[model samples]
Target: MSDQKDILKNLKTSSIDRRLSIAKASFLAGTRWATSNATSFFSSEKDKEKKRKQVLREQARYLVSEIGKLKGSIVKIGQMMALYGEHFLPREVTEELNTLNNQTIALDWDSIYPHLKNELGSKILDLEIDPNPIGTASLAQVHRAKRKSDNLDIVLKIQYPGVANAIDSDMNLFKQMLKLTHLLPQTREFDQWFEEVREMMHREVDYHLEAQTTQRFAHYLKDDSRYVVPTVIDDYCSSQVLCMTFESGISVNSPDVLTLSQERRNLIGEAALEIAVNELFVWGEMQTDPNFGNYLVRLAEKSDEQDQIVLLDFGAIRQFDKDLLSVAHDLILAGYDHDLDKMVLAMRGYSFFEQIPANIKPDMAKVFLIATEPFSSLKNNPDIPEGIMDEEDRYDWKLSHLHNRVMQRASKSMASRYFSIPPKEFMFISRKFIGAYTFMTVIDAKTNLRNMITRLN
Candidate 1:
């Protein structure tokens, strides 16, 4: 909540300085962890387990705090790991890493002005730019500006001076820090995911790609009145800056959104879900980052107007391969039918699914059924809990508790040996669906999605 001021005159772009900082933090955390293990050796058996978990949490928290202090790609690296490393990282460690703050301390205008001027050049004189940042993040800060000729409102996303160039080195240092603290496992799976994080990091900083993506989404949703995608201003865009017309809206979770009628909320929720479905089934590309900050709900001011969901920030877009998309489509279709045989068949062609034991495939299929419950009619899925679906066949997201049930079933079915890290593509697709599910739950939407899924098929 702090305003942009002189918190950091400049980012520490020097590799030597960042390396030393991470090394020092890792060494201290490592020492504490070693001391805790040595102390646990003399404890009673039952107490040992309890004491060790507590110390692990403490060490994880200490490491995250240190990482939080160094605001740049490293902070983003921690966040990416927290989001995708659930299978490989210790639960306690990932939980602590999740606490790494994304709303970093803002750099002062004096420091930011130079970068803005360099990107905008003489175009900077044509607009009235706000000296204070409207929002701040680890890699960039956003400011509001207006055109002098038309008084048009727009927002500029300005990347930090050297964050992009530092990504590769910062990533290497982050891995070393984890190694020094003995918090992460060194394996092929971890190595592969690490590379994924690196690619996503680079993509996030590429303003040209983000602008094109924004324009792409805008074109796709242009005819849909229920959604709004900001117009990209090409003249104001640069490799380091993205400019788009300012679209006003409230947070999706705002109290004001909850005040709307049930019908209105359902419409809003469905619009959000349709975007996810279209991304997976039609376009084969998705905005993988689902942070609430990227969405805003624009409540209609008049009875004749419709409520709208404003989509923002297209930096984390992930494009899917055709083979993977086909498999994903099969899984959903099989889940809709609640047929274990079809579900098992759909699991073909994916490496992770191929690795699962044949006997356990049925159990995994059941998990898939639970996940796609909202898209199934009561006739197709008779085992759905009573009161979860209404007489009208609407699925109440707030009451379903589907996420927990899926987790429980997956844990009950897959033995430790059979469980493996999913493909990176699956992780992004699943995350997008989960984000949509969360949006519906937050809006208290009771939507009958059977028609939607059937139409897609």
Candidate 2:
């Protein structure tokens, strides 16, 4: 068996190199397409508009097909770019890359059975499982199962069989393409982003790492009955198989949240924010993916409006850099207090940029004010008198317009834009904040947001 693994390792290495070579070739083809399209459009070449569009269409087809042919880190990066949408790439490219996220083929039992047997030994059939998968994502999927000993029902997350090798090959290709196309940020300090992502994705493919991350997160929030994270099943866990006690909660995506008591919905929103703020400002650890699927509202054991929030998935956790996080805390506080200079100094310091033009400095403060949703709703009007937050009236046009302007400027800025990708540790923290606020807005729960802001002080 050891000899067979060694042989497979050799083949895996060779296959990876071949995959990288193909990826580089694909990137080159993309570059050619972009160059031709640009030249045709810019130089007034024959059938310029039509040919340029056609060139892009062809590039889209090739990239979509080629990216799907690979998996692991490269495809994952492509999907992130797609999700980022118009912020990072053209709509066409984003649309093409989005398909790569869930397109990888699942492993059949022929391949997975060996590992199942290895995990549970010859007693596999004694345990219960639905051979069909319950949920499938990029690197893993869950199966509904019951234990033989006590009939303990649980969710078993099986890591895809070959994703580790695939991720290694694909990310190397992604790194190569980043260097070639300069699609990644141009800063030297954050050059380690890809390497860090590689390390994380490697950890992600290993069930032990995910298990440990989940355990630590659970422990952190253990005292708070208001929130929940899945518990790890150490006895049943393996390098590729993770089993956790099952959870049954529904996501809050439906408009029917309107029917949910406004007070109850507000509690959900407030709890999420409390968790997010505490995590980012105090604890430093956060689960960053902002997918709505990460959250579920479970009705309380004894009551209706009194329910617990269920958190699922922890693969993409990021820790905050202490200095950066501290600056963020100070900046948000300063912005709320309406101290322009203080906010400006904090913003520039928080930005890690020493100098900015005098003209843009004031706009910067205004920008930050508008970006902080709750405070921006006050709109710098001291005489308007603060009012209680209304759950249904939570959406702020000011915040949305402000974000749109900021995103537009960021999308256009080739220079300062790269400086803004927060250290990866802060990704989940930001996501948590965004998700919490959005949820709150949906519920229209009025709170003394100022009181919440002052807690940082």
**Top candidate when judged by lDDT against the true structure:** 1
> How do the predictions measure up, each by TM-score?
0.96, 0.78
Q: Which ten residues in a row have the lowest lDDT in candidate 1?
A: 1-10
What lDDT tens digits, residue by residue, belong to model 1 across residues 1-457?
Answer: 2433536777777888888888899899889889888988988988998987887788889888878777888888898888888878888988998887544677777888998999999999998998778878878888999999999999999998888989999999988888878777988988999999999999999999999999999988888899999999999999999999999999999999988999999989888888888998988899998878889999999999999999989999999989999998898888778787999899998888887788888878888888888877788878889999887778899999988888787778763344457778888887888888899999999988887789867
Per-candidate RMSD, Å? 1.6, 6.2
Give the poorly placed runs of model 2, Cα more than 4 Å off. Answer: 1-58, 69-73, 83-91, 102-105, 120-126, 175-192, 255-258, 300-305, 348-351, 355-360, 375-402, 405-432, 435-448
Enumerate residue pairs that collide in model 1. Answer: none
Model 2 earns a TM-score of: 0.78
Off by over 4 Å in 1: 1-6, 415-420
